[model samples]
Target: TAHRWIGRAYFFAGVFPAGIAVLGVAPLSSTGFVSQVGNTMLAVLWLATSIAGYRMARQRRFVEHRRWMIRSFALTTSIVLNRAWLILFVILLLPHVDTTYGGDQDAMIRAAAGASAWMSWVVNLLVAEWWLERGDARRRTHRTGQAADRRDAA
Candidate 1:
């Protein structure tokens, strides 16, 4: 349960930045007053969620501190991975895609920048989720084995 909450918090933290960035990139005036308000709410919610998660972890209610720590680390790592992915995508994938799409040099640069940014965000989110899930699974398995050993010893 605590682990799940931590995961949710981390998920929201990642989403908040991405959402803010998206809104920053978008033509906000194209939307209405409500949209702007909603964006602000999202930013607030993101911060709240992150704080709640940290508080929960500090409480140390769950014996699965290892699991939570691994998850927190994995979540924090997305930032680094996101930047790396963006750089690689721009340098490698974007050029190929632009050329295949028959864009001129200037057009290709613009397209690559736009596409790489979006793709990098998506890829980073997916990879972060996968890493967290895998880490959780591994932790669970190790815990189960330890429990079994204790039982056998008794």
Candidate 2:
């Protein structure tokens, strides 16, 4: 179905950014050739997922289509959350934690990065769900109005 394809597309879109971030965060020299190969394979998978989703959307599968699109949106949003968390961590948590040996900075940064990523995903998901719900409500209202009008004419 078209919806299914769209969902696939969205799913893949999210995977690409997450994959890149994960790979980038890993120490390149530490992993060796195997890491490089793994990264490449991840990239390939992201591409394939996105293409499939696109194809499904093109087929007019709105249900699956919206699902994937929402997923993609969520995945792309991790950067925003990551940055926000970093700023907050620096402003609020940094001063409270001891900076001896740079341990505090490292810990704060990691925590912020993780929290931000999670927050972004959650916020995006909620927003997408709300929009979809509102749309469905409007459609129902419209249908009801039309039925009332028809009844009046009859």
Candidate 3:
């Protein structure tokens, strides 16, 4: 469908290019190995999920496609959530924490940063899966009720 094409286009033209730029410009020395690896892992997940979603759709496995697309979107959101979480960390911990970035960052700060980077997408996907399962349960209940009603009427 048109939407799928648009998503693919955005991924290739916008997200992919921007990520490559970030990788190119990011100072690995400042980000540290864990953070850098997290970034790369997220980028790969985003691209791979997008492609998987597209392939699922092509095969008419709409349920699987929806799940994959949800995952892809969640991964894409990680970039935005990463910044938001960092800001929140600063706001809440400013009294006891240093907000500066780079090699001199404390162990707690680096741990939080790396965890946030990974959790941004991981949490989103988990939440999405929960929501989807809840929705499906509701639909099944509704259908069961409808069937029961029909049988009673007969």
Candidate 4:
């Protein structure tokens, strides 16, 4: 399964390094403490979800595996989504940051980064759950249609 393979690749390449950097190097840096902590937790969550998905796949619990994969994928894409949020923040709020952060540019940037960091993954996860529910509903509809057709044939 490509999904399983992709999960493996993403775990090794993306999540692992993020965990290492966040848990280790970020602490040494003198910037963005709140965002660093949030992202560190996010990295840990991503790793946990990725491993859970792999375990479900190994156990042949494919439906559960798919659900976890969707979560993992959402977390993975949050990096990109984070940028999108940051862009929105910049466009919509950067100019008004003087009133918000009292003209402290660094503070404003950090606040934006932290908010985007948290929002990206949280929003994506919500959307993923919505997607999963939609998939479940569609599958249920399809099964119902199939059952009706079989009864008619009999």
C-alpha lDDT (0 to 100) for residue 73 of candidate 4: 87
RMSD (Cα, Å) for all candidates, in order, is 8.3, 7.7, 4.0, 2.8
Best model number under TM-score: 4
lDDT of 4 by residue, 1-154 (tens): 7966776777778677776676676455444877777677678778788889878988999989989988988988988988999878777768877898888987877877878878988899899999999999999999999999999999
- Residue pairs with clashing backbones, model 1: none
Q: In candidate 3, what are the lDDT values of residues 58-132, reduced to their tens digit?
A: 898999998888887887788788887767764555455444433444654666676667677777778877887
TM-score of each: 0.45, 0.55, 0.74, 0.80
Residue 40, model 2: Cα distance from true site in angstroms: 16
Lowest lDDT block of 10, candidate 3: 96-105
Give the worst 10-residue stretch by lDDT in candidate 4: 22-31
Prediction-by-prediction clash tally: 0, 9, 0, 0
Model 2 lDDT per residue over 2-37, tens place: 856655444555565666666565345233443344
lDDT of 3: 0.73
CA lDDT scores, all candidates in order: 0.53, 0.57, 0.73, 0.81
Give the runs in model 2 whose Cα sits over 4 Å from its true position: 1-52, 98-103
Off by over 4 Å in 1: 1-24, 28-90, 93-103
TM-score of model 3 vs. true structure: 0.74
Off by over 4 Å in 4: 1-7, 25-33, 147-154
| TM-score, cand. 2 vs. native | 0.55
